[model samples]
Target: MTSRVPRRLYLTIVAGALIMSVAMGIRQSFGLVLGPGAVEWGLSLSTLALAIALHNLVWGLAQPVAGAMADRYGATPVVLVGAIALAAGLALTALLPGLWAAMLGTGVLVGIGLSCTTFGTVLTAVGRAASPERRTAMMGLASAIGSIGSATVVPLSQFMIEADGVATAVTNLAMAMLVAAPLAFAFLATDREATQAPATLTRQLSLGEALKEAAGHRGYILLTLGFFTCGFQLAFFAVHFPSYLVTCHLPVSVGAAALAVYGASNTFGSWFCGQLGTWYRPQYVLAWIYIVRGLAIVALVFLPKTELVALGFAGVLGLLGLGTVPLTSGLIARIFGTGNLGMLFGLCFLNHQIGSFMGAWAGGWLFERTGSFDPIWLATAAAGGIAALLHFPIRDEPVARPALA
Candidate 1:
């Protein structure tokens, strides 16, 4: 089955996967700096959390614009701009002093960068490159391969932090983004070809029409709402889990190990979920992923905190990690078609980023006020349950489109 795929399609998939790997890998590892960053800057947890929250919010706000541009032009230019922004953001965060730099660099700049380079842009390119039958599977493959960034980068960042300091680790991350920037060119030919192909829509809808159609879609609304929990849960874990583990008096290595395990497990989880979407209802699979994830979080929070237990918890999360991306993106493609996929998916992702902002900020706020993460943990678990319910009744069938007049 794999051998039948065109070499050009394969190249697009590989390129997309590598872009995601570098972008997401570095983003996920940001938590490793929380402790040192706070100490070095003499900043409160809430202050740093606000910066991260801003990052999520900014990313959410910008995603629609980025996606629209990708839809209008091509992903190559957007991705190149994103790479430069990411590198610049990291460099600013590392070199500059005080809270403003953190806010502008890690918050606004990195967020803008991520909006262009991550899932919405990259996945849309890959989805457009494949036939509808193979789209979801290829997305899964790209996600699975992309998971390599998190697995490797998280551990490497941890090592760098331990050896040199937060500044050095972050500077190296910037360099890595610069090195990977060339991969953006890979999308040039593929995206142009995909863009020229006949759209699946009965006729091309203006951007306004597309938005109106999506607005009226009950399933799209439900899916968008459910996606909030995904961002909330993931952002919270990515930014705070390391600190949480440290709060429990575990060795720093344990936190790093657990995240590394998460990245590793996510590779399999993403691919498996992607493949599962092809066989079963993607919405239903997404519901189960959330349910299982909620249960895992509950277990980890309440259970004994041993190295083994932590690692095991991380593994469960890893399996459920970004698995949601393929399922959600694939579902949108199914409902609306891939012509406006980037923009539509970006709209859904906006809600996800809003959730991310809340989770990241609330985790720190609650922790600072109550001196415990218990409340937030329970909140996240409940949010997942709510999301699971939202996803269950989604009508995944394609929407009715008016014929071209």
Candidate 2:
């Protein structure tokens, strides 16, 4: 069974990871365009920041709907639609040249696209395909591979932007998304029986009941709240960190390289965290990630701004970066079972997106007002500390349900 599992699921896993790579990789590179695009498009930094912020907001808002659809139908259709939306959003953002177009293309459409393609939808499909025992480890493997996006795409984006221009670079990225669209079909390889196994508690519960159960569970609530910090910290950095480097007089290459390093480091961190979940309680792992993140931010804030320091900071952050994802999703699966994993993880992700919206928007808004990112940096650190506290007390055991009548 173990040997057969890899052969059977390899395509699905690769497809999921590739799709995630394109979605997240392109998403991470948005910061690279901010400085150049702002100048070329004649927009304030705050306006572009709003577009990114709106993207995150729309993504969060649409995630639950997307996840539910994936749960009810399948991941293929949802992912295919997401791929088209992602391509169209990128194309529109490239072709059109106005604020409304930017908002509609990058903010609304891309956000919707991301909701369908990213962790909640994709990982759930992957998780549902794996055996119960192997699920988390498989997810970790996929996530680690998915980190390839940041490592490769960010630098590619930077190169394209420099060689051609912002519009051309974005248009090319759109083409890449279209090229990757077919991979969504691989989701059909998933074993439907595994997902609907009779042993799962959530198999007997309605969506509404599952939501209620999660709402009543203290661990779920804590997990959701802690997730908010993850969003805030990550979004803040992804959107503003490049611009922040410029303010410090660091070259543009430093920003791209830093992001790339973060992505590379994320590969190992995600896999390591996922493996740790198999042996340790996921909640404790999550808590330490947050605590370490907080300290890292504090250190970065106080440290002198140099290319080396920025790169090192990105490496540390990357290590803790998307690691939260596998751990968080795995925790939900552990507590609730894989039956409603998509919807449950989506609900938690909503809170995370809310934090993302705040982080992205607030970073730009605060910087515009104060001409410094220090306040936001401090705030993000504080949020991490709070999230660590919240995760420490979470009960990571599976939910107990009465037998169905």
Candidate 3:
């Protein structure tokens, strides 16, 4: 089955990557608006935090269903629905004044949209389309390129919020998201169609059996547990880091600038990890990334807060921001086979999203209670250490091809 990928498939992957870039990039910038949005809307940080927290939880909860649907039906329809929902959610958040309304808009609609557009559906489509030998590398390229949106959009969003206000900024993002509606057509039905053929190895395992096999594996459990740290750490910073900097007496520009830096830096990390995953055992690479992230957090917590230091911290975070994704998702493809990659990877991401809820909500809750971020920082550091240990024991061997055939 090993063969050269056609030019059209490469174009499809690029379009898919851009689709993810727009979806995830805009979501990452929510933190840029949270502080201003709370002030403008007469809402408390904790209330807004809870909204984002709920968003993560909902995204996780919906991912498996979305993935399963993609596996059964196809990705195009799923993506089309997501693009519409995301646009509508943004429009609602921009127009509505009520907190609960905003929650439904930002928290619920965007969350479900994310489930369909992001890794669960898009990456799975690409994974199944690719040869097994090229799957991880393609995932890496797509995921890494997705970081570009964050790099450009974060600073741009901040600028738009400053010039036009929060509502207009969000509305602009909403309009931009509609681009995905057209891009959704790029995911041809052929790959998913090929899998449905009776004689193919991809057709052997039912969704239920695929899930059962993964659940029974010890390595899968460890991988799931370890992924919690990725969510926890990212969500904490994504939601609270700017405010945390504000508390440090830094200018708001510094916060936005730092996010831009983080986004820019992550591009390299994402690319490197993608390339590294092709050659190395992804588990080891994943392990080192966690350990290094933990150490970086230690430095950020202990070091004095200055504009330069703040930017440096963001740089470190950016470098590690999405670096783990390729390794983790690639590992899932290797272990479980690609037939049910969407649903299986969705389950893994669900764990990450669970941690995401706690991270975003807890930062606000704890800051409200204690009036400081020290505890949140400390907890993230410890979680990183824990994740580093979890990957060590993962059974990295691929499942037997004959078993499915």
Candidate 4:
């Protein structure tokens, strides 16, 4: 029998992907802003790094709460509220630019917004919307589409900054969020329980029980540990890589292009990995992604600093980047079932955020102290190797599938 996604669920996935794109696109541009923002204030790079680091940390801390909210009340309110907060945060940051303001706006508000819109909430919504057979592929496709925002929006932000100003660019993007706000209701209508009988008829397990079980699961624990490296590496690069390139006397355009390639390549690669999730062991896929990342960084460290090499490496990195999300999340659905998928994934992603915190903060702190990014690069490469090893022991058997309705 051929597997198929219902039309309404397909629309739901599209809406979720749209929200993710907006969230990721805006988040990725934080690094781009650093180079120019430094020119504006002459502030230490560490300050910007702190704000971005705080963003990741806050996003991590809030994800579980966001996921729980989605589980209980439906994801629509959570996402709608997030979009409003994001737009407000951006507009306010433009009007009043400072360390504290950036922290409150980008760090706290945008961070909360990110938690609601990105993977945990959105992907869960998609998972619940899809049939078991089609869910994995849909997960990959959603991830791919959402990632495109990064490619398109990062450069768009760069252009706006060059032509108008950073303030103007940010404010305009804030205005754009208003257009996407209506899509949230789609998730509410096709909610996790929409296709099911009354909640009471389903097998009963309190949210507390779910949490306790996941906390104790060996595979889940290992999965969370491995994800830490992803958070660390991506956040560090997102906020610091552009500045790192500029310090090397490369043109800013190379940095922009690298991010663009990252977003673009990740779109295809994530989908490919998502499809792989159904056909192969997800743990193996996750392991390979980390291994590739580690080897790529090592190679880059030893190579010449030519723009050709930098952009080429970036394109390759982008291809490998973000393939983990579907694999990891698919693993979650496979191993534990999707009953508490949002909350469980949220917990795992919390580790990712913690890693993001370390990555962003370490990049700034290390660079400021040492005046070079070498130490952090070495650490990231090592972390990648360690993470690759961590995933190997996860038992890959499919468990009882959750009623995703």
Q: Cα RMSDs of all predictions?
A: 1.8, 1.6, 1.9, 2.7
Q: Candidate 4, residues 49-109: lDDT per residue as tens digits?
A: 7877888999999998998788777888888998898888787777788877788887888
Clashes of each: 0, 0, 0, 1
As for candidate 3, its clashing pairs are none
Lowest lDDT sum, 10 consecutive residues, model 1, at 192-201
lDDT of 2 by residue, 231-272 (tens): 999999998998899899998788899999999999998888
| Model 1 misplaced regions, further than 4 Å | 1-5, 197-201
lDDT for model 2, please.
0.89
Each model's C-alpha lDDT?
Answer: 0.89, 0.89, 0.85, 0.83
Candidate 1 pairs with clashing backbones = none
Model 1 per-residue lDDT tens digits across residues 48-124: 88988898999999998999899888899999999899889889988985799999999999999999989999999
Give the per-residue lDDT of model 3 (tens digit) for 115-184. 9888788878777777778878877777778788888889889999999999999999988889666787
What C-alpha root-mean-square deviation, in Å, does candidate 2 show against the real structure?
Answer: 1.6
Candidate ordering by TM-score (highest first): 1, 2, 3, 4
Model 1's lDDT to the true fold? 0.89
Model 4: CA > 4 A from native: 1-5, 192-202, 398-405
**What is the Cα-based TM-score of model 3?**
0.96
